[model samples]
Target: MKTLGRVLTAMITPFHADGSVDFDGAVALANHLLDNGSDGIVVCGTTGESPTIANEDKLTLFRRIVDVCGDKGSIIANTGSNDTLRSVEFTKQAAATGVDAVMAVVPYYNKPNQKGLYAHFKAIAEATTLPIIVYNVPGRTGGKIIPATIEQLHRDFPNIAAVKEASGDVNVASEIYRRIPTDFMIYSGDDGLTLPILAVGGCGIISVAAHVVGKDLNEMIQAFERGEVTKAREIHARLLPIFDAMFVTTNPIPVKYAVRRLGLPAGPFHLPMCEPSEEEAAVIDAALKMIK
Candidate 1:
């Protein structure tokens, strides 16, 4: 089993002034993250406004990012949807785009049971040769892919390679890590718990905060790996406020704003997603001041 390295930024989808997906802006953003510290880029995850983007657009986005950074950094494509059939199709298409791996989120809104979750991912896993990262963000999906089910999938499919544990329960993540093989990777899907997850034997993170603070996040991971617990904890502590702020609103809003605030190519939010509220904006502004 291969690892997608430790500090991947679940990057935001940059837009043009008119709100169209900005391919140039995306190439620039991918390059910028690589230049800063990101080892990989999750191109169309929640932080990239995946729910709002069209299938054709996502394919274009995936192809473009792969074209730009597939060699430089691992390029992961978020191809999961609530519909298994659609996710299967998307995963195959995404694999064709040359991404290093595809992240299949636990089916949202439909709330599948463990058996159903197993089958849903099982079908997708069977459909493609690309390595899969099972995303379990129950807060958003209203369903959890429990540790046992993950173990089952891991046993059943070699391509079902990793889990993005965003359930916010460190114990649950720890249990999953203990059950899986050392090569079967587990990454914290939440930014706030990156160090906590690492302490519990997690491999790394699929991070939203890395968009704004890639270098620090990467340094924190390296510090921990080098047995510098105090240094890693300190970096984690210093980054907490910004991590807290990036999520001040629902994801991508505050983060997209943060990227824009730094004079990056992040353009504007799509509808159903919008700009941060004034209070939230103030919170974000206050938080960003800590970075430099």
Candidate 2:
């Protein structure tokens, strides 16, 4: 399977002040990220507040971004959930929305074993012709899809294209790299590990900080590909603080605040999530300055 572009923003969902999904703001942010430097956009992923968003809203958002971006970049949707049947159903619906692909995460909370993991993903893949990007963020999803299972899925399904690796274990990523086919894609789900993952044969990143520093992140990837390893390291070091700040609170809180702070259309976070603390806000502000 072929890969999407290197730098994909796990984009944040922009909201209205009243907590409604801000469709216009989302379109604007999608355009903004692509124009700035992101090669693709992953809508409704963890960063996009998928937990709070309704299914209808996700379909609507997918349509808006696909309509705006057209063939310019990949507009991938997050259709994964704890329920395999629900994931399969949503994946088909998302494919109908004209997104380039759909990402089904490792089922969180249910904590499926490797066998269950492979079965869950295989079911989703079988239901849709759209390429599947299997997300394995153990921090978010309690189970880890080991390399053997991932390789098995890949061997079984041609449409099972990539994995968003956020296990925060470089060794696990390295093992995946060593075992999987060279053509199979492995993307760093964490921003700070982009360069390290690349050094170990991972392809690129699906990033949060890219919402703010996408140009730098894209440049870092290009630099590494060009054999300018030192320059890539410098870019990574320069970006470290912003990456840390975005997660200072739970994701989307700091990032949503960061977007609004930059005067973008990002409104506010939804319930069960709120604005960053004064100190966290200060840290985010300072981190934004490093790039500015």
Candidate 3:
């Protein structure tokens, strides 16, 4: 069960003045993230304004991202939606495009039991040949993908390759690490948790903080891998404040603000996901500056 290594940027969706998807800006961000140190790119994640994107638009976006990434990074298509059938459809489309993987979160708003969570992912797994990564970010998705379910899923489907553990409960993540197949991967869905997760045997992260702060993320992982635990922890500690501020507002909003600060073409956002307040942008800018 192959999965991503090190960190992958959960890119923010950029938009033009008319609210159209800014394809050019997105390509630039993807390029920047890869050049800076992102091992992969998780396109259309919750942090990427996923809900506001339409099915047709998502198809094109996935295709475009795959083309843009080439082999520079893994193109992890966030195929999850509120409905099982819709999520499956998107997953199959994502597989058709040959993306590296599909990240499916538990159904949101209308929460489901463990059986339902298992079945939702089962349906998605059956739909696509691409490896399925269960994304557990209860803060946004309402429900968590428990480790027990992941253990069962991996047992049943060899293609159910990994979990993105963002629930922020290390104990839960540790329990997951204890049971899953050795080959199956666990990614720190939270940037702040990457080193800790790695210390506990996690692979790495699918990080929003990495959208603007990727070099340090890569360095921390590299240091740890090279047995430089002290240096890795120091970088991790310094990165915590920026990581906290990145989520100070909801996801892509703050990331988009940081991208604009980098003098990128980041502008306007999709509905329900607008730009941060001037004060908020300033705070994000200050954090980005400290790292830069």
lDDT of 2: 0.90
lDDT of 3: 0.84
Poorest lDDT segment (10 consecutive residues) of candidate 1 = 1-10
Tens-digit per-residue lDDT, 175-251, candidate 2: 88888848788899999999999888788899999999999999999999999999999998988899999989888
Expressed as tens digits, the lDDT of each residue in 22-92 for candidate 1 is 99899999999988889998988988999888899999988988887778899999999999999999899
> Which scores greater on TM-score, model 2 or model 3?
2
lDDT of each: 0.91, 0.90, 0.84
Q: Which residue pairs collide in model 2, if any?
A: none
Total colliding residue pairs, candidate 3: 0
Candidate 1 wrongly placed segments (more than 4 Å) = none
Flag clash pairs in model 3: none
Question: TM-score of the candidate numbered 3?
Answer: 0.96
Clashes of each: 0, 0, 0
